[model samples]
Target: MRPGYGHTLRYLGAARGAITRRQPIFPTCYGDALQGSPVADITADPQSGWTGVHPAILAMNCLAYDAATLGNHEFNFGLPWLTRMLSAARHPVTCANLKLTCGRFLPPYLLLDRMIRSHDGEKHPIRIGIIGLVPPQVTSWDHLHLGDRLISEDMVKASRELVPRIREEGADLIVALAHTGIDTGPAHPFMENAALQIAAVPGVDALLAGHSHQIFPDSTVPGTDGGAVDSAIGTLSGTPAVMAGFGGSHLGILDLALRRHHGHWTITGHRSEARPVTSMKTGIAAAPDAEISRALTKTHAATLRLTRRPIGHSPAPLHSYLAMVGDSAALRLVNAAQHEAMAELLRGTAHENLPILSATAPFKAGGRGGPGHYTDIPAGPLKLRHAADLYIFPNTLCGLQITGALLRDWLERAASCFNRIGPDARGVPLLNPEMPSHDFDVISGLTYRIDLSQPARHAPGGALASPGATRIRDLRHAGKPVRASDVFILATNSYRAYGGGGYPDLPDTERIHTGKTQVRDVLVRHIRSRSQVAPPAGVTWSFASQPGASAILETGPGVRRHAAELAALGATDLGGGSGGFVRLHLPFDGPLASRGNDN
Candidate 1:
């Protein structure tokens, strides 16, 4: 999130912009979890964990951010760690929907008293109230850390309740920092994306939307094409709302025409836009801020040192370019690490007799982060930092004992990541837009097939889509069909076992063991325990064959280099795709496990 503070100062029609400027820029941030996503606040420095703040916070303070809010990723680390990080922010961090278990809540809104210059060279006083909101699904996504301690309320509901109070506090304007995306559909309780509904709230004058990382008012983006979002004018449901792109790629600017009607401050008309900060052809537009660079010198060096530490070796390349459609060497190595760690924890336990099924996911599947987001580690010596590329999140390990029926339901929920396809549907999208790539989990120790022609049993948010519907075909273990009454112990990360993805909820009794060790550490330990680690032999799941059907899978453009890999799976390269992605025509003609990690 390296943005040029000086460029923003020049674009806003100010002769001088600094600590003494009276025009008031009102520089507010939509929200991102942590700095750089370079392991989200983890560094080689000793004082940079739970007790110390990340360099990103220091950069924000140096750049002078007025206010900010929480994103779902903010809850990835436990509460103690998050509380320590927020204490370092120079600006107020507000979120109306977040409630703590101690019968208290974080700052819901901020009342800022500012002065703006009039047309006749006079200064006018304005009181602006900014209320913050995060997605209610934060609890589910970080269920391990947020287990009953923290609860997230619905976005629209919180706005309805808090906006009136802000107005009662004698504020002229109210802006909502809604960390969500624009949705034209009907508003429901506990919905993850709800900017369109929050915009319709009576007292809210304007809103800054985020969370999906899709830029509003941009016709080329996927989520902004809805009817409620007038992409031409940057308005959501007639409210002046703006959603900038992620990682500081774009800046959301909202210009309001202030008018005094009968002595009350009113907004007549406004201009809104999401401005790109850097161009792909020309690189960064302005000089790098020296203050920001100096503040991050120590952390940047520490991070580089952390990423370069060596671990072990690999015989074949590990990449996630084909994770969405086929087997992944990246995930295969993670599953092995998770299963090995859980075995040592359950060696003397009473549940040791039960079989352990390791569940892992493909984190770098080229979703919103663009085509270059996938992990592509070359064969040879491995480094400690490669563990970060393979296992992105800072999640801990946990083991859960559940019946076979619940396991099937878990896989069914993961199956909701794809859309329903018919036998005759050709060249349709292979993925569901509402589902994030992290929710697509591939569990090991079981062989199953997902039927794309059938409707998904659950929706993207874990709601029941079809009753008695089955998308998992022929679930089996050890070459035998699994029964509903059979029992198994699943070793997974705290996010999934406690409730990270929209999987089913299990009680405390169901959890056999929850380790305090991070999954990345377990991966490091597993790799070091062997002379040279190799990718798993076979895949755990495959697509159920559908005749004369095909789908398009968007991935990194680098997939073209693996020509023999694509030929083995009978996939066709559709060339460059929209939004800087490459398209692969998936015909489902052969088993995905037919090929290994070879070029």
Candidate 2:
């Protein structure tokens, strides 16, 4: 339910309108209903982060939804802010595993009473139950806002505890509004994607998965075939399930066939599939519902005004097509903005004497978002929209005190995003496809080398896979080797400081400061202070030399304009690939050399 952005909400209304025209439906959103990427942080009210409440909630109510669940992104602002947004939900927006610091407060599940007509036209009384659960990672992902103030229980554990209660309440059918992806693997504690396990929980009748942003029941999606998941018919562990594509692209539909047996309700058969609002593949679309556009016009106008506000100017083109491989001007801008603000705050503090480093990640790189997702800001005046592109999340500013030993470990975790490429290897995929681009944070104030020839020390989950493994080489600070005992004050978002994206678990005592000001606010300030900004072209890190070794790196098709930068790093363009991506043949054939200003 994107409000401030494009007509995705209108398309959502279109999907709802078309579906309901055939028959009445119990529409349920898995999560992330109130915001879209980039402009997602934009709220209806500036103080409220806008919450998308005016249109998101208003439109949800208009669509006549029975129930909706909270997504992990819902917690991005804070619990208090989220509470206010949820209060306006005309339909119940529930979350089972969420609770107040004091005790269980948010209702874990919701029940609905309705009359159902059987195939023979027999009307019977029925009670439907919905259990909502967000990813367990939210506790770590948004720990700064969730810490001590709220508690998030693991999804499967909470389901085991709450399912029986729903059954005892006389519910004939139960639907799991799981705001997590379907992972066919065996269940474990704190698993971020656990829909398959949730469906396996006894008494669970159906499941709806989200957060992965991929359509389930699509055979093209890996892990769906030859497993507990049956994508052809959209069943998980024999339970009807569907995961609608993300960003209001599709609507999931699950039809259940039920019959009365011995005075009890039983589900006999089921089918499920996702209906797309518009598809480039098939070139089909649902017409935009005019009511939603009319209802949201006022907010949309304000959004346009907000987006066009000026911030600063760019000296040259800044894009993230090359962010993952080498020096990225886009990322450098974010780090420079962060470094300046945190530096000012630390000036009068006790930890001011320590050298400062900024941790930043690439958010818009081409991955799950497809080839058009990478940031490409041409040289011109910077606006709020450009700033939003630089920093997608509405995370708060946080600073932590860390020893050099921990800093080295942090890089090891980030380095795991790449796949192991042995010496003299050629044409291997440089990145682990499962590794999200946002998790690959590169420290701005250091020079290091990533030896892809070595196995990753840390696994994608941020756990130590090999105790003695090392991928980061020649780690340095201020042109010298960093000692284990030496300390540094790190400038980062609250998400990273609290172990978001599986970086590390830092103790609360290590938190030197937690500023209420949003990181974007500081970035705006940093940009406005400068007449024109141009981040250094040099990179902070480089891949260790592997003569005769080349790897495949795909970026947005916009890479055609930056051919000169490609030559500097000894890379060649391989033209376009399916899904609008431009592939690159990055050859690590040259000798390793020093990079960036920190050196």
Candidate 3:
């Protein structure tokens, strides 16, 4: 969830209001109800709903018990809003691992004890120590808002210090609400993650794991150390770990079985599962939680009005074509916006004499985004929230001067997003399911073709030969090859400009310029100024030279029809074994060194 993704404050306030009014207290779930739909559209809130504190806090409040830890997406709103949200939480928000720049916990870990009813109908008091830990990546991704107020501490050291102390306080259960993810891929610290490490901590009974947004293959994951077990309810370090799915799509429930033996407690059994917010296997339905909605209605209204004000109109829905092989309506629009905005920024920079271009990866396109990733806005007014939906990241506009050689290498990285799949493929392909939304490419200002026959210069290595190569073959300028020495002024987000995605060339540029406006603002300005938007003129590509070309080649019927017309002219859909594309390389015959002054 983003900074204010939940209506947590309002939900808490409403719950408090109910308590003051002496009314029956039944919590209502906020946001969209899961009713067996594509996971992409599971939590569609155009404005006030999931964009801010509403979703995160609403979900946090729903699983009300004690303190909950913050996650990376929590900083999407920056520190001020996060602080405000944390301050407003009914229960103390604790994270011992995080230190402010002043060297102190934002909210110290709490020594909490509560009374519970045992299965035998006996009342028992249990001392439970809770500590929350958020991912430090927030400092890099959302630095604009965080400034210097927030700093993340080492998770291992934080757990190490707090464990013995909690036990000394006579606590029976040590619960770590770790926002870091677990090992979904291979089991390594970089891959397997610290959830296992946190679970292996002495005196820690259970671990509450969040952030990765995944389901455990089994209820119990063994700890690195013997005599310890990691369960969904809590980690064997002491207890199990549970993570409610993003946007309230699921409520993670961990039931722990504890038995008293010789006046001491022992965990008997435990289990955990992601209870879908809505059951879609049956049909689409509204399983709205009226109470939570009503509580947050006022706050949700203000946030929506603040963020969703219409900027312009679109003839068709501006949707994203994320992972699929075609440009999305929304992504194309953003690409056009970035292309235009970057060109303008370049014109004012020292590299104005060089050919200027802009490119952005479709971060929120396809993959886990599901079918809802498509940008299909009806012919209607456009709003800031709509723009937010188009460009989800809070990235700043940055420009770099890179030679065509480096530019090609960068494109190679973008092309690596695809993987080779065949009928006889073994197990799951090396393709990482969690390559992050922003890694997918959607280019503008330049047209190129990707050849899957070559290999990718993927991470930790430069380039190696492999049958599973993703290379740009027919990269064109006007109607010919782009010279190796061609200097291109590229406009991109600061994330890439600073080498965040391992695109080191962007940061090593000789000339770097940071723009005042954000990418989304530029897009909003572009749309409002245009007043009317149209579908892309045309974009195409091809890859039929490979072995498995025919089976892998496909596009929407609309694109296929256009391809047929293009094919009738001279372009044959080259049957490539990996995949096929309708070639759309525009002709740029302008002078190589033409400057804005000359124009």
Question: Which model scores highest in TM-score?
Answer: 2
Worst 10 residues of 3 by lDDT: 8-17
Candidate 1 lDDT by residue in tens digits, 47-129: 43333456667778887888887777777776776777778889888889989978656888989887776655556677889
* lDDT for 366 (candidate 1): 75
Query: What TM-score fits each model?
Result: 0.89, 0.90, 0.72
Mark the 10 consecutive residues where model 2 has the least summed lDDT.
5-14
- What is the per-residue lDDT of model 2 for residues 487-552, given as tens digits with 9 covering 90 to 100? 998999987888877777688889888877778888888889999986855568988878778899
Candidate 3: list runs displaced more than 4 Å: 1-65, 184-193, 217-239, 284-286, 303-308, 321-323, 371-373, 401-406, 422-432, 454-470, 476-487, 495-511, 514-516, 534-547, 550-599
RMSD of 3: 9.6
For 1-599, candidate 3 gives per-residue lDDT tens digits of 32211211110111111211111112212211211111111133343344434434554565563555666655644555556555545656676766778777555465766554444445556676776676554565555556577776667667778889878877866667676656422233222146667776777766656555443423434444443444433443444655544444455555555555555555555555545545646534346668767666655566566566778888765544323344456666776777777777667656667776667766554333332333345558887667776776656777778877777777777666545433233222323444544665555556666554455555322122343454777676645577679887777776566555546533334546765466777887888888587635545233323332222222222233344333332323433211122222211111111111111
Model 2 scores a C-alpha lDDT of 0.76
lDDT of each: 0.76, 0.76, 0.52
Global Cα RMSD, each model:
4.4, 4.5, 9.6
Clashing pairs in 1: 495-500
Per-residue error (Å), model 1, residue 352: 0.8
